[model samples]
Target: MADSSAPVLLGCDFSSSPSRRKPVVLALGRREGLRVQLTALECFDTLAAFGQWLAQPGDWVGGFDLPFGLPRELVQALGWPEDWLACMQHYRGLGRDQIRAQFAAFCRARPVGGKFAHRATDGPAGSSPSMKWVNPPVAYMLHAGVPLLLDAGAHLPGLHAGDARRVALEAYPGLLAREILARRSYKSDDRAKQTPDRLIARNDVVHALEMGQTRLGLRLKLSHAQRDALVQDASGDSLDAVLCLMQAAWAQQRHAEGDALYGLPQRFDGLEGWIVTA
Candidate 1:
């Protein structure tokens, strides 16, 4: 059994709009020494439900899989506020159509290869641009998520100030998963795309994490059932959440060693948030 008094850690795989078929998955865990243990998995079928859960009283550090801020170049080009808080406020007021129109116009004017403005962290993290609206639709995720974190009063280090007990760090699961999978596709939401090869890749990812093969150097502890479940989820949402959990564990370790920025670079663009492990 895990220690009851250990501080809780969370890894969230978020979505802009959630439903019973596609929920936001949160992997709840705790780090003991260099080992991170999976404790529970929570799924929220609605954004309002997830918001309520985030607002609940708790003492936890979470690595949330959503972009916390936009690219500085994109914001500046759009004439949005330079200050992170002010920018988020202005962003929240615009409709999705307006965002699409403005962002589309911006992209159309740019060179073919340099269409999307990227955050400084993007190079290291290898993540999709936060402003992307189609495919993964991260822009919508940001629009839906940042407000909830703010309303929840969770402290976003170097971005927003709020509850000390509930620290929220931006996380990118692909950053860790790619370190192990190396472009091998481990998941697909489409039923037809969830092939046997992807299944193998998911299992490989779980095995690597258990062995502490990643640069994070923290082993993941799981019960047999938990291990099986992580590998068996065809969509890989659960596994992605666990990957975020590892990043959260790493940040926790850094905090224990006295880095208040929670493993983020000491000098990163405030208008473009950094991923925890990047």
Candidate 2:
């Protein structure tokens, strides 16, 4: 249902360090009926360059793989500043050791079973706890990622400020990957788990998306060579971006259906909405 005339749906797979490696890979496309055309995939080597791209005026809905905010309970418990930008600035000033120490202290004070606090969006998105540092390291991801969006003046659907024409949504590739190969670890950026089977599994997920098996009911239309390129890229940046692109497509479709904020459900509770394309 996305407006066929919209320029493009932008999806980003973000890297904390854009300089040392391919920091961000973006997939550009839009929905056409049940298919998402893959117009281009580009990688950025620096946050500055990515920011430049974000700053450019365009009609886009994007699914960015980054945590948007901290849990309200955690913020309150830490007695951090209530203002979002102020709190993030305070957090950014702390060294990793400091963050770990403070978070550890909080955990020690809380009951073992309730170590992490939940965000209002969690119940709806089924996202990992925002405080979790390992496995997904979403807490750190949020810490590293949100400020960039804020600095870029991007609009987060449920969490931050931005114009309606350009939208941002928090998206997790793990959610989509797990849907098909549940219990079977498919891919990992960690070298230890980057096995042949995991590579194949990544391919399988890509193929499924191309074949339209995802919950969004949209197929990714990619060239055979592009598919091969995505499969061969061990970093999985392109694939992750494509996954985000699909989410954007779904959001745009919902927007076209009259949801001003795209397809984000009305009752998010604690979970923050991922930015989606316009």
Candidate 3:
């Protein structure tokens, strides 16, 4: 078992251009034995501000819901640097339009079913391609997120190095949620789309977390207001953040048990990061 009081854990629901309409959500918590407490929640209006938060002095292992690298096949095809750091450096220098055009051009010649190349981690993680810039625009999230994490000196397991005490792992809440909900939509950004059924799903998810039903063997302890806030956020950002927090807690537990990659596979591609616990 881990010590009675573990280091702070973080779950970040990132937005490339976070604003009032879509602010970055952060969940802060600590795990003791099997119980993880929901200590607090915060919102950041910009990536820069979130970077500032990352730079703060703290010991934490965070599960950030963003890709930390592009697919190795994609990088090789583009003739970008084979090295992850070099590739990310090159990627950061491009504007969003340039990114889109470049990706589109890459896909233009490929067959329809195989338009986009995938990271080895994608199939299992159910993550969008890091090169994808539309719909969820996760590619941009990677572009916007990783550089800041690098600059803040947060260590990205299997990707980049920084503060060992401030470790950050690639996280996907949907991967965990989907294991239980299985294609059921539990959240919608549109208020009109936030129906009662999704509310029930959210409630069920919360109940599952509190009951220690996931493979993580972790239970959540939330105050009355905190639980209410998680259920009330129909967008599911809060719940997603919590999901990622549980991932962080689970990873920490694995680390404590002597899994150096913090529960990630021993052979995950360094070029394409693995989602925690996936």
Q: Tell me the TM-score of each prediction against the true structure.
A: 0.98, 0.86, 0.97
Q: Provide backbone clash counts, one per model.
A: 0, 17, 0
Q: Assess the local accuracy of residue 56 in candidate 1 as a C-alpha lDDT between 0 and 100.
A: 92
Candidate 1 lDDT over 1-278, as tens digits, reads 55567569999999899999989999999998889999999999999999999999888899999999999989989888999999999999999999999999999999999999899999999989999999889999999999999999999999988998899999999999999989899999999999999999999999999999999999999999999999999999999999999999999889989999989999998889999989
- What lDDT does candidate 2 reach at residue 76? 84
Candidates sorted on lDDT, descending: 1, 3, 2
lDDT per residue, candidate 3, 1-278, as tens digits? 43545689999999998998789999999888789988899999988889999888878999999988887878888899988888889999999998899889999989989988888888888888878888789989998998998888888777776778889999999998987788899999998999999999998899899999988899999988999899889999999999999999999989989887899998888887788887
- Please name the candidate that would achieve the greatest lDDT relative to the true structure: 1
- Residue range with the least summed lDDT across 10 consecutive positions in model 3: 1-10
Model 2 regions more than 4 Å off: 1-4, 81-98, 123-126, 269-278
Candidates' C-alpha lDDT: 0.93, 0.75, 0.89
Task: Compare the candidates by TM-score and give the number of the best one.
Answer: 1
